[model samples]
Target: MAKVIMVQGTMSNAGKSLIAAGLCRIFKQDGCRTAPFKSQNMALNSFITTEGLEMGRAQVMQAEAAGIAPMVCMNPILLKPTNHTGSQVIVNGEVLGNMSAREYFAYKKQLIPDIKRAFRKLEEYADIIVIEGAGSPAEINLKENDIVNMGLAEMVDAPVLLVGDIDRGGVFAQLLGTLMLLEDSERERVKGLIINKFRGDKSILDPGVKMLYEKGNVPVVGVVPYMELALEDEDSLTERFDQKEEGLIDIAVIHYPRISNFTDFNVFEQMPEVTVRYVTSISELHHPDMIFLPGSKNTMGDLKWMRQNGLEAVIKRMAEDIPVFGICGGYQMSGYEISDPYQVEEGGKIRGMELLPVVTVLQSEKKRCQTKGKIGMLKGCFHELFECEYQGYEIHMGQTSYMLNNSVQNVCENVISENGKNVYGSYVHGLFDHGNIAYRIVKILAEKKGIRIKDGVFEDYQVFKEKQYDKLADTLRRYLDMEEIYGMLREAHLE
Candidate 1:
């Protein structure tokens, strides 16, 4: 048995995932074999493991931080939201059908064996397992069948570290209230408390931290400061909502109801001249030079939302002369129509923007493979020798066919665009991952707006991602008591 230490957040997006990842790095650096585990993760952003299993991207990031290959065993259950009320549940990387919040809670208890089975495999090589909790365990109403938080802590007999986000305010109440809410048996499992995302001086929070330790009787292990580590977020809530300013271009992305893999836009956010914003409402869709319709878990549902909110027209009007790009589901929406004969998501058929003479058919079989291809000269106003290298993975159930423009040659059907500087669509996510491709496209847009981009504004994503992991590892080493924590791991008895 591997010694486990779990990190439970006071609320969602309280930096629990980052902390868990940090600990994973710390353990790995200290010469102890480590792995990350989360019993359940509800997010649209996911990755298909090498074993052809789908799991949350957070654990995958953590596993990478630990210098381990990601597996479905890292995250046994994943929920990819289809809409507000329901999501498609994935058990051990296989879809178990769609279920609502209420239904999933009742059904999840039966999957204890699956979670254990996955963990058992990780325990084989891991000397320590860093666990992450979902949402707040303080949800008294949902704690009964809570296989994610304190319930999971109890299940594995792992010591817990409750983390609170000071940046959100009410840090004292958030931690204390959560501890008070947990049952005696559950509360006892929490060995320490952490204050995360602190912005001010450590001395300012010292009194409060001391008070919490004395009053709550929990060890004040550490106070983690707000560090802008460029890591991939689990979902849109964390990634899209960030108010960071990158470049001069004010690129707006539609925050669909079922947005997935929004991380594709993170590359743009790193540039010093770009500002990426996610807007869900039509009024918020201010006049921007470029607009991106990102990937979605449910294309039809989000398209229906686009139509309902009159965003489809906004996008069309904006694309009259301005640039518009779509990826995956958004690519399907850029076509003439979307049909599902098998009715995988909604019944029958749906319509899409007739910007490009293309159509899509939803099939039961999903396409999940990493693909590399060249951006051959696409039919657009600013077409140049775009024989650039681009690579990304696919994770969609729809098969798309394109009706190319008469003049366009040597083009794949997967990438169809209007014969102007307007509409563009591709099945590829992270199309901007290639620095040259992104720089050229942005340079074109910049020329139109009379903005000149300086040299070296583009980042090589392959290099940047590795840098991000190193930053994550180094940040953990600086903030956490890695030596003392490693002592705990060394002392832990594997029985």
Candidate 2:
């Protein structure tokens, strides 16, 4: 059996995923076979494995940090929120159907067997398993059937490292309050406490750290400094959306309420000459060189939101002059109409932006797969993308077909565009992560706007991500108590 160490946070977005990824990297560097496991993940940001299995992107990021291929077993259960009270549940690698919050809460306990089986599969290949927990283990109302936090820790007999976010303020209350809420056995499982995202001198925090240790009866493992990492964020709470426009090339992204896979645009942030901003309202939607529509979890609902908020009209008017691009759900929304007879969303039929010459039918089944193909022959503004070979993944629930005798042409195998060619739509995410795609697009827009770009393009994003992982491991090693962490794993082996 593999020794297990779990990272649980005081609240959501408390750096649990990054800390687990850092530990995975550290373990791999120490020459131990390492893998990451998250029993259940509830997020819109997801990934499609090479084997065509769907999983949460958080585990995939952790697996990458550990230098291992991503697998659905790493995240056995994924809950993607489709609405306020419901989610589409994925078990192992396939869809199990959508369930309301109450329905899933009652049904989750029955999946314990599947969770244990996933753990056993990881144990067979890994010497150490870095487990990541969702939300807070102290959510008392949710503690009963929780299979992702303390519940999973106890099930696997894994020691926990409870992490608190110092940057969010109330670190003391967050940590101590969580400990106060846990049962005696659950509290005992937490072997250490980590204060993450610290931005000040350690001396000032020393007094509080000491008190926390005395109160919680756990060692203060580390006060990790705030480091700007170019890593893929887990979900919509990511700081990427808060970025202010700075770069010469401005790309405005419509900030949909249920946006998913926004990481598709992370590569643009790597370029010094490009600025990617998320605009929510008409006031914030300044005239940009290009407008981008991102993937959404609930296409019909979000489209209704756009119409109600006046974004639908604003984007259609903007598309008349500027280059407009859409991906996945956004791609579906850019078409003439979207029909959901199966009730994938609340609306049965809705009109699209009419930017593309196609119609979409939302289906019960989802398409999840990794694809590689060259961009088809294109015209007009985005002709730069012509014949560009790119690799990306597709994750959506609808199929789009061109309207009869429409002048719009297929841009790629999975992409379509209007005849005017200023508007483009595709179901492929991560389309900009490949060779010169983002660069060429930005360059063309910059030239049209008469703005000069000094830097040509960025390095391979995969290489850039690997370097970030190394930096993450180095940061953890420098700040965290490695000897103590290693001792925990060693003791687990002896047991």
Candidate 3:
């Protein structure tokens, strides 16, 4: 059996996923075949593999870190929230069904065998497997049925490295509190603790580390310095995003209550001059060059939310001047009105921004697959920019009916837009990843703002990320006690 070591965190967004990726890269660089595994992930951001299978983007980034092709099995189970109380479950990259939080908890255990099978397959080819645990294992109530944290550790009998963000302060408390909350067996699984995202002098933390070791009865393996790694974040509250200011384009994205696929803008953020900001208040809408309405799991509810926040009126006012782009739920919101007969979100016809003379009807069937189509001549202010064909895909639930030819037209049957500036919507996410498509839009926006863009303005996002992973791997190699980590993994395999 291949050596397996899990990276569990003291809390959510504790840098567990990033640490896992760095470890995977380090192992691969050491001439060992490595892969990343996460028992389960719950997030709105997702990616479609080359096989047309859906998976969390974090696993994909980790795969890239390991110099391996991404696979659906890497993330066998994914839960995308459709609303606060309910989520759409995806097993093996296929839509299982929608389940409420309570229902999911009751049924999640039965999927353990599937997770084990996927892990076994990965182990067969990999010399090492870096598993990531979701949230925290210290949740007393969830520990019983926990397949993602301690339960997964016990299932695979894998040694774990508990990671805590030292920069957040209370690092000792977070680590100690987690250890205190875990059962005896769960605590035994933790081989060491890593103080991650540390800043300032390491010697200053020596006393704190000494105290931690004395009290927690676990070795302080290493104090990892705060490294700015440009990788895709696993969840909404990404620390990387929190640190950076908006880029150049002055993009104001409407913050929906049930936003899904906001990760679609990850590609746009690659441009040095593009600024992507999420705004909830109407005052923040300002004079953005472009307004993007992102996908929402709940269309009618988000539409209702827009009206409640006076965003419906604000969006209409902005549409008249600048270009408005919508995707999925945002695309549904671009029509004249949206009607949900099935009571998907409070059940009824809701008034839309009425920018485009179109209507969208919510349906039961959800589109949960990969798409690829060429971008043609999209009629809009961006036409001169996106004149050439590009490629992308679509994922949405509502069906749109356009009232006029000018109201909506498909460019190469992929990109969608209304007469010039009023409305632009598409099901395609990650459309800006393609450099040509990205540069064209930036060029137009720059011209509109009386600015000029130099050549190679939009860097290739994948290449940029690979460079980031390389730097991250180097950082991990320097700071982390790799020998100690390898020894723990070997012990797990022997067991």
Candidate 4:
């Protein structure tokens, strides 16, 4: 069996995911074969593995830190919210069905066998496993049926390191309150407490840290400082979306209510000359060199929302003047019409932005794959993109059919416009992952705006991310007591 250690947070965005990722990096650095596991994840942010299996992007990031390929077993169950009440339930990389809160709550306990099986599979492959829990373990109403947090800790006999965000304020309360809410058995499972996202000098927080150790009766394992990293974020709770700063080249991305895989745009932020803003409303959206419609979990509904909020009209009018691009759900929305025949989404046909000569029909089955192909002949704003070989992944439940004219050519399953205009879209995520593609896009945009881009602003995506993981590991090693963490893992395995 693999030695196990789990990181649980006092609240959502309490820095659990990043901390867990840091540990994964540490374990890998120590030459321990490590894997990250989560019994369940609830987020629209997700990734498709090379085998076409789906998993949470958080686990994918952790797997990257471990220097390993991401697998669906890392996140056995994923719930993507479609509305306030219901979500699309994905079990082991395939959709089980849509379930409401009441229905899933009653049914989740049945997934124990699945979780156990996945964990066992990980143990066979790893010397150690870094597990992450979702949200807080202190929800009394939901604790009984919990398969994450303390419940999962007990299940896998994994010791927990509870993390609280000091930057959010009330860190003391957050940690103590969570400990207070847990049952005695659950509390004993917590090996240590960590104060995450702390700013300022260590001496100023010394008294508070001492108080926390005395009151909580758990060792203060670490006080990690707030870090500004360009790594991928876990979910919509990410602060990357609210950024409104402008740069030499401004690119606006429409923020849907249930956006998924917004990491596609993260590569764009690598360049100092470019600014990418997530526009929630028309007022937040201003003139930009390019406009992007990102992937959404609820495409039809978001399109409707765009219509009611008048963003759709603005985008359509703006498409006439500037370059417009879309991905996945956004690609579906940019067509002539979208029809959900099997009610995969809210049923019925809806009018699209009419930007492309394509029509999309949502199917009951989803296609998930890592695909690569040569870029077809394109025209207009990014005609330079043509003949450039690119690689990306596809995760969508719709099939689009477009009438190809002189300009539109098949770049795998993507589309482009005629020479005189700039409207294009693709179902592939990570379209900019090819460093040169990202670099070239910036170059094209800068040229159009009559600006100069700085050199050495981009590198291979894998290289950039690996350096980030190392930076994270170095920070954790400097502040966190790795000896204590290793002891916890040892103790868990011995029993």
**Model 4: pairs clashing at backbone N, Cα or C within 3 Å:** none
Residue 362, candidate 1: alpha-carbon lDDT = 91
lDDT of 3: 0.80
Off by over 4 Å in 4: 404-412, 491-495
Full-model lDDT for every candidate: 0.80, 0.88, 0.80, 0.88
Off by over 4 Å in 2: 406-412, 455-457, 490-495
Q: Candidate 1 regions off by >4 Å? A: 234-236, 242-247, 404-414, 490-495
TM-score of each: 0.91, 0.96, 0.92, 0.97
For model 2, residues 1-495, the per-residue Cα lDDT tens digits are 788898999999999999999999999998999999999998888999988889999998999999999988899999999878999999998999989999999999999999988888888889999999999999899989889998888788889999999998999999999999999999889889999999978999999999998998999999999989999776857898897765778889999889998888999888777889998898888888888899999898889999999998988888888989999999999988899998888757999988887888888888889998888866569877888888989988887877777554433366666787699888888898888888888778878989776574567788889999999999999999999988776323321
Predicted candidate 4 versus true structure: per-residue lDDT over 196-217, tens digit per residue: 9988999999998899889989
Instruction: For residue 239, give model 3's deviation from the true position in Å.
Output: 4.2
Local accuracy of candidate 3 as per-residue lDDT tens digits, 80-120: 88777888899988789889999999999899888988887
Better of 3 and 4 by TM-score: 4
The residue-level lDDT of candidate 4 at 40 comes to 98
> Could you tell me the lDDT of residue 449 within candidate 2?
87
Model 2, total clashes: 0
